[model samples]
Target: MSLPVPIDLHVRSYGRVRESDRHAYAQLVLPLDGAVALEIEGRERMLDPLQAAFIAPGATHSQYAEGLNRSFIVDVAPATLDPVVGDRLHERRFAPVGPEARKLVEFMRLLVERGAATPALVAGWAPLLLDTLALDAARPLSRLDALLARVEADPGAPWTAESMARCAGLSPSRLHALFREEHDTTPRAWLLQLRLARVCAWLGAAELPIAELALRAGFSDQSALTRAMRRSLGTTPAEFRRRRRT
Candidate 1:
């Protein structure tokens, strides 16, 4: 079962993790080659190829490595995960990669090794790996498919839950309930996911200035976009763009 979400999966590392800071997006550090020293909250540990770290959104964390190290990094949206699984993961800092989860990690590593981690391939694998980490399946399909399509088509629009509810011809509270029932998320969170997905895809698939891309993705400013991306994907826009280009 693959409980997928709007996530950005990249195979890379942040060398010499010093001062600790935190973001609002949950992240997983699954080692693929070497060891990474990771500290979540106040707990410290060394992560090897078979080990992984689950960093809950807004939890203080940092990392460092003495030599060559790269891990399969997953930047996940917490709202998209099963609430129980997400809470359980947040309570724990480290876990041995289970057989099924390791298989997904290995598959990603192999694809990267073969230079086959194209947008389409990565897109398909991203949600699976995210879901596997939480051991959950996908969210239920939304009944408002038409409204969803319109949102996808113009993600940069000034969209609020109220506006979306009006578009769908429902009261705002009713729309919120429907989103929760059908999508397992709120209207605002869903819209954020749509915008973030667009930004990630565009960062990997095209060339544009960060500021320009920010507005085009419905972010109010460059800093706002950066904060949102860092909070949700566990990576800055520059690093994400660099990874795609190189």
Candidate 2:
């Protein structure tokens, strides 16, 4: 096969609910609009126009996007990239796309839009884009710094909006208002996202039983877990494990 031949390239949108998957080919997600919360190998980060995410072959990953989101994606075969570069890229999660690289990305996006992104053009641009990518940058401080830290540190805790409001030293109404202002979501929704994130992070441990994992994530039972997983991720725990287990 030609080195420049990518497995796939296209623009895609993600939903508000969290979903998980893993694939044999590496992928790069460059946002065309809006931001996405992406998790790979248990690490979570936000991906926006200024930032992009890289997923290594076979890595278990999950995503949730706020509002509307569309991104340019390139799925690359493992053998298509240089061994050294691919190895380095496997560890890359979210990284800053420099000004020049952004320009190149825009140019290529226009080409793809115009139906001009041929195989050779993609092959050439793909590696060059990867080469230009740097390591993940320092994260920006979150608006809900203290509250988010506590919740993230203990996502499985029996957390309620009232409890969270107490922890944050805000009234329930004020807390809800603040979440809506900053995150465009309510307290319950954010906590659910946190619990779901915990589920994804722990799902990779093959020895840990799914039922136990569900309880740990604060779900009532395996049935509840399955329902939540299906509602948020469109897949059951068993299917996620079967497809994503390394």
Candidate 3:
């Protein structure tokens, strides 16, 4: 018998599940904070905050969570999922959630917290989230894309052209060429733009001191953040925050 609403959402904290378990429904495991290591079919995969692991129904697996980790576990019945998404889940075990998936996860979290976990709501949104997971899996990512995801995950990292080239397994010149071809900008410029945008976003949302905000956003100091903001938006971080509040 098919379940009426085959969607289940769970929030888990740091722990270890050693018993090899398999279920009739596929599971999506998203690490919202810290990290999780899952052993599936005798192979171990580390899942960072930006990635999710999909466990095919009846696949033997166990998981361990590092300190203070928070994760979301979504169980989807094969019969309820779109065939394409179900097939994709069966094929790939891990996928990057990206921005779209993060937003959907946040929305789901809100719904669960608000006591709004109705069968109708699950029926309406589960398919969309699964479809997003499938699409992210289907898209082909370049070496640059992989590096960029790492950078985006930690924008405060000290990044240099040579260091980034090493990460991509490409020569510095080749990395430059690839960036120019893909983004029409040098790697440093692109990174700076990303940092500036992140700083601006943080300014609007956080009440951190200017120096802390600058440091968090990958700037050397408050003055460096000010210069970049002035160059890009012609406004200081203070002014940007003021405007956002107004």
Candidate 4:
């Protein structure tokens, strides 16, 4: 008998994250094409098609993707893995992708493609991938959470360095310093990224009209949303929806 699969699978086509959606799952994300940048732990790295990232569950992590970044995400829950693997992965720090890690991603892609197998059987085949990678990750767990939390809380809000710093109880200078140190990007840029993400999420989940989504996502008008959406995600709302349905 095989162990059950511990992941809830969802396929995302073209979208970015909203500032208010800073929720991270314990999982593996492998980009089949394009590139993804993430602030995992406290380090920022860009993942290409050849790379994979293992974000520990409940850890504050955020992702930014460029163009049409197609990927497969393996959502892992701690309860699904063995105690040894779970403990090790949970305690590990954030790190960059490695060659050995890429092999696991390739194996996973193959496993997923071969057939629809039981989660337990799949887990058994890749028992140690998480734990082994955990050993190599640099631990930066505490710094990114609060900022990410603020973003997740309100991606539509007009977030400025001064305003966000006040929200986080830090000075603008301190917030900028910390933001750069942790994510390799400015607070302003992160805010823009989050806004775009919200646009994507709203487009994906809600039935609201384009105008409402544009305003809710902080876009000034329909044209604004159209321009930004095309620049950031490379697709219009109608096109995205059509592709999503098919």
Best by lDDT: 3
Clashing pairs in 2: none
Global fold similarity of model 3 (TM-score):
0.66
Total backbone clashes of model 3? 0
Lowest lDDT 10-residue stretch of candidate 2: 134-143
lDDT of 3 at 135: 82
- Pitting candidate 2 against candidate 4, the one with the higher lDDT is 2
- 1-246, model 2: which lDDT tens digit per residue? 222445567899999889998887888888866778999999998887677888888899999987887888888888776677666666567767654456467667656654568878887888878777643233343335457655654567889999999998889999998888777899998888767666765665435898898888888888988998899999998888777653
Q: Each model's TM-score, in the order given?
A: 0.48, 0.52, 0.66, 0.48
Instruction: Give me the runs in candidate 1 sitting further than 4 Å from their true place.
Output: 1-5, 17-19, 118-127, 134-246
Query: How big is the positional error of residue 6 in model 1, measured in Å on the Cα after superposition?
Result: 1.8
- Candidate rank order under lDDT: 3, 2, 1, 4
Q: Write one digit per residue (lDDT tens) for candidate 4, span 57-135.
A: 6666677765776676667666665666556555543343443454454455444543444566565645555655564
Candidate 2 structure, TM-score to reference: 0.52
lDDT of 1 by residue, 61-88 (tens): 8888887877888777766555676675
Candidate 4 lDDT at 182 equals 64
Give one digit per residue, the lDDT tens place, for model 3 in 115-178: 5567777667778887887887877655576677567667788999999999989999999999
Ordered from best to worst TM-score, the candidate numbers read: 3, 2, 1, 4
